[model samples]
Target: MAKRASRRSAAEDPSWACPCGTGLPYADCCGPVHRGEGTAGTAEALMRSRFSAFAVGDTDYLLRSWHSSTRPARLRLDPGQRWIRLEIVATERGGLFDSTGTVAFRAHYREAGRPGTLDEHSRFVREDGRWVYLDAQPD
Candidate 1:
């Protein structure tokens, strides 16, 4: 079997801001999470990290942060699709004290030079002491 590629740090530039809209440097925000040096402290944080993963093509991070029941064996990112921005719309109960939560957001992207957006309300759960993505609520 071929060895899966590990997630590389998206923070190649020390001064780049995090794609998660945290207003923090990539190294201070999602980069540590992507690098396995830390974990997201809340469901919202997990959601943000996952979005950053998509933006940076960190498939391993995406898989690790996904709940096993809903996690796929592999993830493929479209190189043609460039994630540009994220707009958080709402969050429900996915706090430090809560075991589960939901986040609604709009992810802006560009594909083949055309712009688009994906709006979703994602569910998250705390499993084995970490927040992991569960599923997206059906529209």
Candidate 2:
């Protein structure tokens, strides 16, 4: 028989501190979108918040922030999963009026008693004056 595996939840995972090292929770810092209280105003800000949302398994926020042009109809979360760490490699901006941006990041997580990593360069575009996730590039 296979060894038993312990399930993990979001609360059991390590909490991410603000980029500022203020020791603040991500949900408290950039969790609100309707309140217009998010600190992520630029492309990078949006990217960070999205990553944080993923860490917390905030699928609704992720879907809401995604661009309609490329956003999928639904997002699924795997049970017994928890994100480990996030590493943003690079970010670049297009022209002011272009309203397009890119972010390269590596996201590591654990699920189903296994560890996994996802590295991608994601594309983002500003539509209707809001930044939205477009797609991811293969490594």
Candidate 3:
């Protein structure tokens, strides 16, 4: 986990705006979807905003972005954790109008004295003209 986090920090977009920003306020952007007010436009966009939510401890947004079919009944973030970085490896658009989409990425974080990574190939679906996160598969 240490190695993975180091590599990502060394070789990725270090200054990206997190869709939510650094002050922990997401209301203008990712906050809406995180609050279940709206949905994202693309799989990658949703994924990025979700990462932003994690960085700021917005579990509500995480669940809201999740597809109804796959969204967990309860969601929580470790109180001792902090997200360190996000790396979007690949993304596919224009795949299907209402069927499928994917975003492959790795999220690095530190928790309870340990550094860890969450790597996933996430699926998305478009419903009612908005894109929502479906689920994640091992990379």
The digit string of per-residue lDDT tens for model 2 on 1-139 reads 9765332233233364543222565445554542356535667667777766666666877888888878889999775666667677888883355589888877788888899988889888887787878888676
> What does candidate 1's lDDT look like per residue over 2-100, in tens digits?
774332443556787888898998888999999999999898999999998998888999999999999999999997897878999999999999999
Clashing pairs in 3: 34-61
- Relative to the unseen true structure, what is the C-alpha lDDT of residue 81 in candidate 3, on a scale of 0 to 100? 80
Per-model lDDT: 0.90, 0.67, 0.67
Tens-place lDDT digits, model 3, residues 19-38: 33333334555655655666
Query: Residue 124 in model 1: shift from native, Å?
Result: 0.1
Model 2 ranges off by over 4 Å: 1-23, 34-36, 94-98
TM-score of each model, in listed order = 0.92, 0.73, 0.69
Count of backbone collisions within predicted model 1: 0
Instruction: Provide the clashing-pair count of each candidate structure.
Output: 0, 0, 1
List the lowest-lDDT window of 10 residues for candidate 3. 6-15
Error of model 1, residue 40, in angstroms = 0.7
